[model samples]
Target: MQGFQQSVDIQSLISPLDWVVFAFTIALTAASVLYGNSLKKKTTNEKDNFLDLLLMGRKLTLPLFVSTLVATWYGGIFGVTEIAFNNGIYNFITQGAFWYVAYLIFAFFIIHKIKSYQAVTLPDLIGKMFGPNSAKLSALFNLFNVLPIAYTISLGLFLQTLFGGELLFNMSIGLIFVVLYSMWGGLRSVVFSDIIQFFVMCLGVFLVFSTSISTFGGLDFLKANLPTTHFEPLGGHGLATTLVWGLIALSTLVDPNFYQRCFAAESEKTAKKGIIISTGIWFLFDICTTFGAMYARAVLPEAESSTAYLTYAVQLLPDGLRGLFLAGILATILSTLDSYLFLAGTTITFDLLPIKWREKVSIHHLGVLSTAFISLILAYHFDGNIKLVWKTLGSYSAACLLLPVLFGYLFPGKISDKQFLFSSILGIVFTTYWRNAPLPGFYAQIDELYAGIVATSMGLIICRTLANFRSN
Candidate 1:
């Protein structure tokens, strides 16, 4: 009787119009990928086809660049809302603002250098500057870096919330669509789908924001309902916690999705301008989501905290708009899911395996399958806590690889090969130890992120100082 009652409630939340919009959004995404594939010419050269498939033939304009980049960057949409619902506007300040600074840094300093390299992958560029061994090592960590599970879990939870089902049942079905679109068109397909997704996402969020403000009162209502810490920039968290988030933001410098888009841009100027423009759009979207989540909490305080945004959205929005909003959530996840799956494949075929770029085409497809399986396993492992799923993966990558990748680009040969190797290895080792089994004392107080940063930095300093002394 209880189970039947739950199903009845779920059915009430979605109407016939909502189903039409949801199905249409998905069908349109599939059509877009098929349309992209049809653009390939019979006589296209292998070299040209390779470039076309992976990097969109290095011809992304400013608008395409902005849409794909922004859409892909925020895959953990439900997670963002979860934070906002619980913590208030601080979600925007930490998750959105910290990342904005990192994006600007990448734009001003890194994008030009990356585009100038003409490298297909971050490991390829690292191999050129550091060494093949360094590239291979970075690839191992990059595999951990781009796991698609966080977004997969987000998609799964969204489905389970909207339709009501076991978590794994929804996730398994979600993975099929993700792998299908990703495998069909590669990056071109991903970008094309992103163009559709970007608009849907923006429209859905805006409708909810507008409706919420109109129906539920505005800032005054939020101010009265939310706790003071909700508006606090730091959210009562200390410097250490905030700084850890900043460090995670710094991981953007090493993010392959950013590298792929920058590499795909028609020119350095386009990449630069695109990132700047995208940042503004992200800021606006952040306002909508952050406020929307706050409204959800205010209106539905007793709702399941994980699905608060969707719950309030459905309750507040009209029939068609409810479906559109859910589609936006799926769009947000699918865009990132496909990008990460592809990049993870690149790590396997292009980075880990020593095959010529032109000859290793099939390997990429195989790698995609491998990534999907691994991501599914990880999704199950971390499904218990959605927030920790992303944090754990982000911490591991940021702690171990962020510094070496940054120095490789910025400082180049200033750090010797031996130093670079030790730094990266020690960073991984210290991070694992800090996370799992640090000595109980002052050491226990140090987070894995800080420990990894200190260990890696020490390796570089020691090597450089010894070299200087010996030269003198």
Candidate 2:
């Protein structure tokens, strides 16, 4: 119970009305996820067991699956964090849309190839092409990337700031809201919540933002307040740097979430449609959130963290509106947490744990325990994780995935076991080290992308070449 009293600084100015809005949103999200689950159960005779819990009974519908997949990447902080630091206009480029565009490119070719293999997870596909050794190693790298997860700290900071020490009840409940919902409902719960959340966040964020901009001397006020250079190309970087910025942005495509969505979908058509549509919606959502950060920059003081949109919301919004805004934030956080717990649990169960456990142990118990355990460990280890957990997710993700999925598609039989192993290793090494080139520009990202792309490409080419030579 004492651990329930964990104190972290949050910047909220929320009141009683805010609590009502949040409660309503949670109830609504819960209902939606359960409804979706019920439909799936009715269609299939699959009893609700751990395997079903682990994989949503493999009956995930098109709409809910798409919403859940999109929410996996469109985190509350992901939308709101960069707005202030980059001055809104500059950060417009770093978005989930580009990620979707990346998906669009892959959907026509790569996804079908991956699906053809009937691989349960990405590693399963790799093992078929490369070897068991590579799959095992790939899992290790994935664990490295996925482990030390964040959103806990970001959420913690926001929730603490939102309540601002007013009510003992609010802080405790808000802090555990993500951990609780995620643990209780698993992936099914997370997706349902996300459908409600994404829309609410869109509405609440737009209102808080548009209202704040109107209040604080309008558009002219922002222009006058922000540094003139804020509008400059690259913010502070130079010409070659901006070009590099454009290309490096392309690297967002080669992420784990990219292929994971394909696997998560009910069918290939739904998978393709959901991702493309989500891209557009995500773009609109990002714009509103970034504008809020820009408005905050014009009016609010510098806080302990740059990623403090919730902080601005608490201190800025009217009491009634603040409730709506906080509720939106909770919706986003819950969707993200529940989805992550499900993913994490699967990484262990489907991805790591013994398949034979079904013969000996209860799969339901295993699914629940593993999900809760990983969620708790990751929650506590939130502090020790590598760079912004998102970036770490991106980093660990980019290397392991980029090569195999693409090769598995275009040059299917060409990829050799040796090539897949070495290329992925190189990709990981380059991503981990090249991140700190000290240029304070896109060059750093460019270098990392080059490292991943070149390594992956070379591996594929070399493998195919060798295979051909041997045949000749």
- In terms of TM-score, the best-performing candidate is 1
Task: Give candidate 1 misplaced runs (Cα > 4 Å).
Answer: 1-8, 356-358, 438-442
**What's the count of clashing pairs in each model shown?**
0, 8
Among the numbered candidates, top lDDT falls to 1
Q: Tens-digit lDDT track for model 2 on 1-472? A: 1111122344334467877777777688778867856654433333345434544545557777667765666454633455444545656554433455565676665666666665555566677866876776666655544432454444554554554443333323544555555555455566677788877777777887777766676768778877765565455655543443344344444444455556656777777677667677777777777667776665553543344466566666777777778777766665565555455545565556665653222443355445545544555554523134554455455554655656655666666667777767766676656665565565554646455556666666777788789999
Task: List, residue by residue over 1-472, the lDDT tens digit for candidate 1.
Answer: 1111211254577889999999999889878778867875654476676677688888888988999998997788888898899989778987899999999999998886776678988878887777877788878888888988888798888778766889888888888878876876678899989988998998888888999899878989988878888888887887787788889988988888888899999999999999999999999999999999998887776667777887777777878988898889889888888899888977787778767653355667888889988988889988646688767878877887888878877787776666678888998888888889947887777678998999888877787789899999
The lowest-lDDT stretch of 10 consecutive residues in candidate 2 is 1-10
